[model samples]
Target: MSVDAERPAPLMHAWRHPAPKGAAGRCIGARTDLPVDRRKAKRLAHRIRAIARREGLPRAVATSPLARCRDVGRWLRRFGFRHVVDAQLAELDFGRWDGRCWEAIDAAEIAAWSADLVGHAPGGGESVRVLLSRVRAVHARAPAALLVTHGGWLSAAVWLALGEAHAPTAATWPKAPGYGRRVILWRLQAPALHRPSDR
Candidate 1:
């Protein structure tokens, strides 16, 4: 829903899943459902709840269907928060490369993807364009809400929040936040850039 210009802007909290147990240094995308680290998950959840209580509890909580994110979503329930599993929050489907160690992937294919990051569909999976479109659609529906999802999805959302003006250079692109870390984005004062039902 679009926020009113006269009313206060809603708060948004976007959190990345803690590292998956067996997928470190691998391309574990939407095609993988690796288990999460329970200790880290619980610790992050506690910190998230603490932040929500400080910033005003989120109006809603949402997560990707992947277990890594869903596990964290389950923890949010401990504080009496209900969450929705949204397919849009899923990581980019790595297609044939899913679950494969990054070092093992074809170097040429990786270079091609790097060359056309926004349009290339590496391993026959989705493109950056498609991912950002999905993220913007979700934001249009809930301008501000708590989100638990994958690193790629979080990166795309942050890119959109910054305005999709140009591709980031090595120095400009942000480092993905650490596992279980939280990042907040305050929607700008401009008119809602998307329609809730547009997509």
Candidate 2:
């Protein structure tokens, strides 16, 4: 069957940038524009495109509000997914912590909030719940999707999928969005089911 843009299959995929050596963050002074090793971009892109093609995610488009993400989208455009959207997938606007590194951010407040990460941000950023809500909104829009979002976004998605908890860490959030672990395994269902232990 031929893949058509208007009626592509539904799927959610998470892809990470190669690494944060010399990309978006601009922390690295001067290096190749590619977030990942340029020598390997072709190979990586080729591999990703193959998977997308194989999975029938021909419309395997991406959504993100970050320029870096868009830049990555542009790179992957040729893989039959020229459609990349900017959907506020960036880390919750730290509001105050946008540019400051972790060390530069207020430590005492950071420490206070770190104790309970789900509900607070160190420098008045978004809480995990809020972030999950926003990302879930995006998730709700499509039956299948491929988000070029940060690690935090992935973590929340994982939580929503499994209804379980995992350790959150500084490295949890991506400096630049990359391929997320492809594990949106369960089919979407409503909250109407009565659990066996619902007492």
Overall lDDT per candidate, in order of appearance: 0.75, 0.50
Each model's TM-score?
A: 0.84, 0.66
Runs in model 1 with CA error above 4 Å?
Answer: 1-11, 167-172, 188-199
lDDT of 1 by residue, 28-146 (tens): 89998998888877776777777778767674689999998888778888767787999999999888989999999999999888888878887889887798788777778876688
- How accurate locally is residue 104 in candidate 2, as Cα lDDT from 0 to 100? 63
> How many clashing residue pairs are found in candidate 2?
12
- Candidate 2, residues 1-199, lDDT tens digits: the string is 2334653343356654334344344222111223445534444456556667776665565745554344556557765566567555664556566554556656777676667777775456567767768767776775566555555565556555544345444444323224422333132222211111100
- Top candidate on TM-score is 1
Cα distance off (Å), candidate 1, residue 33: 0.8
**Candidate 2: where are CA atoms >4 Å away?**
1-11, 22-44, 165-199
